[model samples]
Target: MASSSSPPEEQYGTESTDNYETTCWGCGLRVMLPSGASIFKCGWCGAITNQNKKKREQKCFGWRVLRDRCFLSSVIIFMLFVIFGGVWAVYPIVFSISLLWGIFHSIITTILSIATVSFFSLAAFRCAGTPPNILWGSYPTVGQGDLENYTFCLYCSKPKSPRAHHCRSCGKCILDMDHHCPFIGNCVGAANHYSFVCFLISAVLSTIYVSIMSVYASLHIWPSLSYSLGRLKGMTGRDLAWRLMNEILIAFLRSTLFLSSRGLLLAYLFIASVSLQIGLSVLLWQQLSFIYQGKTYLSNLSSHADNEEEKKDCQNLVRFFGFQHPVSRFFSNFRVTQKRHDT
Candidate 1:
């Protein structure tokens, strides 16, 4: 007998109501509900079932993969060009300055190049934290709450953890996914997030160094500015600023006509490095801010949707860097000893 007042969708058990029987993916048990019911959780195994969700055919999967590969290859080629081109073009001027100075810059360049490339490789090639496999699909094997807050991943044909997000481009579910970076041809997630951050830091430093060295080299070889500033000697403030900029621009254009191939390359490298520096610095700042707020880029968006308050704390940064437990344990021991003595 069915209760008259109970909602048809809320009813459970194997007996069908208007042929609305469905099987639980977790427990592999038949359950009955109304035809309108599209979402439900198994009472026995607590596995969420969403009848509305289905595997989506990715039509542009190949195109996305190709795009990522192209971007990654371009980035690698650009990096190699910068390294070899800068060495060839700038080293002559540097060595001319002094042997000690040249040697010092060589060491710095080697260290920066090694560090930047290493971190970039690690971040790009590493697996971005796959979710651990769990027992499911049978009531006997799957205990209650074993797959708590888990949902069926139609794409993976498996249970997806609450913390995980499916990256369509990566063709997999990534645990604690931040975002997919086409430049690296990888998803930024739990496993590679730190490496990605380190790469950004290293890349920024390398760019700064490259910009400085490019400027040094260019200044040493640049032709003297033929500025006709005798008419504007008495100009002050904004007028002086505008006139000075105009004269510098004219001088630069005139000097470019006489620049050697190496000088031109140094100028190009300086502009490219400065542009990259600004972009990478902004990205690094954004990543650190998200880390300090104890949220990933996706989670931050979800939190905003849910109207949840962000827990902004320095401890989040410390914990993220994996130093919380040891530091807390060291302080806890002294606190425990002091409390024992007081007692």
Candidate 2:
């Protein structure tokens, strides 16, 4: 058992009868002392530890997690992609270029995403358990001294977990806690970290694909609408085509009512709108799918409280990936504190 404060009687030193023996958590040095030994003086390495008990206790943030105003604006851009992209896809008929455009954009975006996620994932993993103050170098935190500890979480309390921080947002210690992105709308923790990367890969591609498709669909619609108007004015098919394609202007006086006998460009409109709509629909649904699964910015690492759920999530994730590494079980957990350090 770890020593706690000695009883009131042992304020300074009691009688010689009150001695207890315990192993040092700091350096494994066996220490024999009074019942009230609150601190351990390690003879081997000269490290001071909370000898009273068995062991003692101990933001890569601010760069990426932007202001609410900037963040909310980014969310708006994504929303517009959904709304307009859907309308455009489901409408008119477009050329084969739409296919190439979507595919090309998706692939390029996916590559970029892969690069980004890879960098952060590897960096955070390497840096886990390192305090942010040391990680970021000297900076003003809300300007608290014991607040030095505020830079890094006490990891359930590990020496340091780089990129790891106590997410007041998450209200738990997180491993490799990157900014909780509300856009994808999830905290980027170690457990769901890969998934967040995957989401970024898929999402950027999906959005770009929808964008090109939306543009193509819109192109087909308005031009066809113009073509129909020309045809309604009793222009010949060839003439109407030229006018709609902006090649020629066919002016014809129908009845004074100005009702043009333009046929509906139903084919182009229907096809383009449908295609754009389908792509957008998929993108939006998948984003929600990611969030619903609780797979977003960070991989959802199980916390101390998530004993059952975290265990399940960890097992499921590891199994799904088919990795059999044992280090996952032992190294992933955080200790409440590290042994106190001395100069």
Candidate 3:
């Protein structure tokens, strides 16, 4: 990393005279230095200037303290829906299709469910993980004025690193910040971006798989219903309406009380699966768009040209999956990147 401290006497030369002035390490404001002054605070930005230490200790609220409990609760509820309505309810119906189909479906569903759970857990860990270090000065220095593309963080009392931004929610400066995601209850930055993307992908795939099974199960239910209603003879409009309503009510009661109706269970799963699938799809599209543009979510909000170095799609994949060989790059499309520090 480039040093952000005051220039050495060899570098500054005669410029290091008693009248020499430097820019504040926090906010770039020109401040005059008193002779023999070692430690001083920035009057403008309120950043304490100390030449010996590049980083200062600041109180940080880690994942547990900063997490949004409500969002976590919602995630748990959704997981339950997938497990009970989607997975458990569809198992028997899949087996009834054929022994071969049952075996195949079981393997696929189990794999997808495990993947979804793993990704979600990883994402949660990343979200609560420690963020990148704040950019602090090595030595006390006067402010010269703010540098281009850099700003001071009043909360961390440190110079914001290139591509870093202060997250009000995190109460700290984050490097390569994308956005604060309410779903994860944390900011998506260079560190955890890959985990977050994986979570979204797995959730979508799992929901879609469940949805297909639900549809198949639903098809099986209509035949049973038709057989039961076949006994009804030609009737008046009012009588037909009453009969259909009563049959639906009975089916619902039977399913709820005995858990015997594949149709009712499949119906519930289908609706929930479709709803979750749509939402996850939208989020996945947005994240992919950001990756394609070589920009973070925050950068996308502005029209300004991105100053950070851009990574190729394959390089991003390698970074995310920690691939060492060239062959692994071919699989980049299925993966996303994260900073090494995040791991």
Candidate 3 per-residue lDDT, tens place, 107-218, comes to 8877887777777666665643343444344333433333333445556665665577777666767777888776666777777778788889988988888888888876
Residue 180's lDDT in candidate 1: 95
Taken over the whole model, the C-alpha lDDT of each candidate is 0.87, 0.43, 0.65
Please write out the lDDT profile of model 2 over residues 46-158, one tens digit for every residue.
33455234322224234334443356466556445444444344332442457665566556545644554454344233322223332221222111122222222333343
- For model 3, the stretches where C-alpha displacement exceeds 4 angstroms are 1-23, 26-67, 127-150, 223-262, 306-343
Best candidate (score: lDDT)? 1
Q: Which ten residues in a row have the lowest lDDT in candidate 2?
A: 137-146
Lowest lDDT 10-mer window, candidate 1? 1-10
Candidate 3 lDDT trough over 10 residues, lowest sum: 1-10
Q: If the candidates were sorted by their lDDT against the true structure, best first, what order would they fall in?
A: 1, 3, 2
What TM-score would you give candidate 3 relative to the actual structure? Answer: 0.63
